[model samples]
Target: MSNNLKKNAISLPGAIAMSIAIMAPAAGMMFVPQVVAQYAGSSVPLVYFIALIGSLFVANTIVQFAKRITHAGSFFAYNSAGLGQTMGFLSGWLLMSGYFVFYPQNILVASFFSSQIITQHLGINIHWSLFSIFFIVIIWYLSTRGISSSMKADLYFVGAEMLIILIVVFAIVLQGGADGHTFEVMTAKGSPSGWSGIFFGMIFAMMTFMGFESAATVAEETSDPKKNIPRAIWGSVVGMGLFYIIVTYSMSIGFGSQNGDEFAKSILAMDYLASTYVGDWLRIAVAIAGIVSAFAISLALNNAAVRVIYTMGREKVFPSKLGITHKKYATPVHAINAVGILTTIIALLMGFIFGPYPVGYGMLGSFGTLPILLLYVLASISLIMFIRKNHRDEFSLWSHGIAPIIGALVMLLPIYGSIFPFPSWPYNLVLTLVLVYILVGFILGLVLKRKTQNLVQDVNKIISSDGSEKL
Candidate 1:
């Protein structure tokens, strides 16, 4: 087995597929709009629009590092390259921990939807664990086959789900929705608490775009890491941002913004909107799209998470056993297996422990979000210091200095919202858990520093390209 992933195995569309799939546009649209609408009132579109702009700012910071560093560790490598190897290892540890935590959210979603479809349509009350086990088996198998194969699957799954979702969105536009096409939903005035509501809702809006950076995680496998990676990152963020806004806008109008109280509570918002605006057939189509979206996201996470582990292992920052790749498939087999086992363990444990829907998904999802959100905040700071030290001559105030500072600051809004005012019960426990995890990472960093002659070298030994190409 080789330590290197299959280089140039993924093209631009394949890379873009990884980002879009993790987002699970259809599933995100079905679930997130309602969650945001609770905070935004009827101004869900406005919140998403705000999140889009914010994401772009942060995306710029990520693009800065990605253009110069291509590695499977993604956030870890970028932070290390720009901030120093210590911060880099911590970033990798935190990001991988986040990925490991978030992996089960996808499985929970897939199982929840699968169980719902089976129960509602077939009247077969099967256990949710059965569906979860089935999907994990499939997800693990696909991931071990190699990224090119998994990404091709991602491309297909993303296309199908988006098509069904877009059809309903278009229908809503053409028919002027339930209350006629209106711009109120795009205005802060429609919010329950005006700009405050809309801005707060932007926190949830940002989560829908959570995995857009997964593209960078597969940089080693992607074609033209320096050029195509930037394109894929920007393309997925902007493209998905627009996609989210349109869907939220359509749903807002379709349900009538005045009816937001009801819209904000619908678990299957897409099914209701499709049925009322289009027909029952489309409602079923949207539901199917949600299921496929869940599956696609699970696969995307499986691919991205394993690669992060594989790179860390190859770098010797983690157990080297995780770095081993299938000689024939050129895939990270051991890391793939690790993610599969962990996700199933976490999903099954949490699902049974807290009930999969409200408590399990909601609390764990929010917790999983913190580390990655912190990655963005940390990466933004790293961008400034990295460019200043590494490419002093090329650094631009707008591009490298002010932009990242703004990006890092804006990225903190969600972090603030996540804890401030203090969340209830188990959610509050996330704070303590996050602190403990970071402390553990810090202690691990100290031990590694003592063992390795040069911690930086060991932390960044894994490489893709020399990263000298002008982008």
Candidate 2:
């Protein structure tokens, strides 16, 4: 196993594109609006606003870490540097697990949209599993081609996704909304559950912005990582933050603020908005955008996930095969292939058992969100601890201390909401599954610590070394 990766393979724009593509604003708008509307009503934008601020705090913590350490492991490296080897190993496990769960979710989304678009426009009804399988192949190939290829593909997908969203937004603005533009949505007046509803909606709203920090995952591959990684992190956070706010507002007004109930009930809110504000042609375009968004996020997740596996493998925390990169491409070929195969299998099994929609919108979607949120909370806490112990002289009250604390606290609200008023069946069980996964990782970490003897020291050495050196 080797720690070497293709150096300076990603430029600043590429890094930013990877982060934004992972967020998949098109997919977020397509799926999130109706759910958010159900809870926050016309205040959907407000929920996004709160989510944006919270995500910024998380992004800030990540950027601070990025400035110091450049590694393929990203959050895993940050955790190792800030906490210890055990915690860092667990962080890698948790993140990898989250992506494993999310891969099926992405597949389901792309499949669903692809099927929907074909059935609606072409009058052809293809099963979603076919689309899922098709996308799996595409993602696998792109991810294995290396960071530069994946980032380039992401750039095109993100551009198209953004253009479609902007078109819809501008159309809504020009024509005016159902009840016209108003500030009432920003308040609790439009929500059925009032402030509680707003808080509840924020849980889902925050999920829409998940993966913006993934820019840090490519630190080893990015040019001038110390400068570009932070820019990418902030760029993705602020860029998507504004995108979510404007798009949500447009959807709110497009659906008519007074028609909150109808909007909440809409399963295809984005398509509905397109039809109402633009035309049927635009509705088809939104569906295409959904497919592109899903693909982009899948690629981004693969890129981030494989790197974590590569780092763990290099450290002998997981299988060493994952640590080895493609000699030609310098990509984590084994890890990428493993993830692609596993994801395809999971997507098929879930689709066969629960049906595509349930696997897509219900189980896989709900399962993926909590684990990632848990990672955010852990990462934020790690940032605070890392700064206090190691970088006290360089730390600021806000950037190092107060910000991460706020970020962790803000992140906790959603984790609590996901569990506590827990819904029925599968969702209530997701937390238990996540706990079991973490426990397994903990035990493995303990075993590795005993076997490796100097695991923590090795991790510290890796973090402390110059970026150009191979571990």
The residue-by-residue lDDT of candidate 2 on 1-471, one tens digit each, is: 345789989999999998888788898888877888888887888888888989999999998888877777887778876777777777887888867776678788789778977897799999899999898898888887778988999999999998998898999988888878887777778888788788778778876788888888888888888899999989999988998899988888887777788889999888888888888888878888988998898888888888888878776777788889888888888888888888888888888888777444567767677777888888998988887876678879899889998998888877777766866777667667777878998888777764333445655665556644533
Cα RMSD for candidate 2?
1.9
| Candidate 1 lDDT by residue in tens digits, 228-345 | 8888989999999999999999999888878787778887788887888788988778878887888898899888889888887776777889988999998989988888998999
User: Can you tell me which runs of candidate 2 are displaced by over 4 Å?
Assistant: 1-3, 451-455, 462-471
RMSD values for the candidates in order, in angstroms, are 2.4, 1.9
Could you estimate the TM-score for every candidate?
0.95, 0.95
By summed lDDT, the worst window of 10 consecutive residues in model 1 runs over 462-471
True lDDT of residue 276, candidate 2: 83
lDDT of 1: 0.82
- Which 10-residue span in candidate 2 carries the lowest summed lDDT? 450-459
